[model samples]
Target: MTKTKKPEFRPNDFVVYPAHGVGKILSIEEQVIAGMSLELFVISFEKDKMTLRVPTNRATEIGMRSLSSPDVVMKALETLKGKARVKRAMWSRRAQEYEQKINSGDLMAIAEVVRDLHRADDQREQSYSERQLYEAALERLTREVAAVSGVDEAGAQKKVDEVLVGRAA
Candidate 1:
């Protein structure tokens, strides 16, 4: 409904999607959809070849948000090296929860999932689902970290893992 409050958005602002990492706000446009005029923020993610249009008014409620602060991102990276929490629950159920957390677009939550699922360099193999979730969370978290830290995704991810290693030792 049009009753949703629209937050002020800016071009070049960094945002995070639940499953995707940091993306930039590319443009704001008004489009007529089904006879209703709506304002949308066009976000671009080159890595994923994806462009998302989020309604300006419902951004916050839908979990569309700006990048986290460096300190916040740092805290998330530190979480990565902590011990994993392997629940005895079934994989499908856990996977659904993980997917929800990822889609929430909350950077810290995503980081927590990433941290809890990460396998150390010498750890045994992860199941197909585990590996998929791990990569999804890792990519989502690192992309936001990279945007906030002004580094590339690979470098940001490397730094996060390095920080984890330091904490482990």
Candidate 2:
């Protein structure tokens, strides 16, 4: 007996791939790989010329998904303005976990990291690794936000900072 594959990805669909948040499906094509033919979705990111091919049936299982709705995006933004949780642990350990969450490509997770690592007007300076992690989280979140909001990445970053500052003020 053989298992059948179900197709969940469609052309022109917007999907958030872990690590590269938001991209649009360019096409679905059959490709031969080592004497086996398989169907894959070709996704393209406008900001970058890179194209990603994902297995049609495993898109969801692998955490590839469409962008959250407006309400979802708003909720994620609101989450960014909340309290920051800094664990009292070694920097190496914390850095590893933060890296994993950023690579997860989930908007909420990215937002959590951004919120937690965000520096305010009165806060002390962050360490080199901390700054690196914060920048990575912010970059990942802004890219997704920009794609969803139809704004540029820098503009989206400013929008996020504005929201955080508004809450802080």
Compute the lDDT for candidate 1: 0.80
Note the Cα lDDT for every prediction shown.
Answer: 0.80, 0.84
* Candidate 2: tens digits of C-alpha lDDT, residues 1-169: 2375665668887788887777899999989999988788999987778898887877878889777777777988999878888899988998998999998987888888989888887889998998999988888788778878888888988898888887753
The TM-scores of all predictions, comma-separated, are 0.90, 0.87
* Runs with alpha carbons beyond 4 Å of true place in candidate 1: 1-5
Per-residue alpha-carbon lDDT of candidate 1 for residues 37-116, written as tens digits (9 for 90 to 100) = 98898999989899999888877777677788888887887676677666888889889888887888887778778877
Model 1 TM-score, 2 decimals: 0.90
Error of 1 at 29 (Å): 0.6
Q: Which prediction has the highest TM-score against the true structure?
A: 1
Which pairs clash inside model 1?
6-57, 18-102
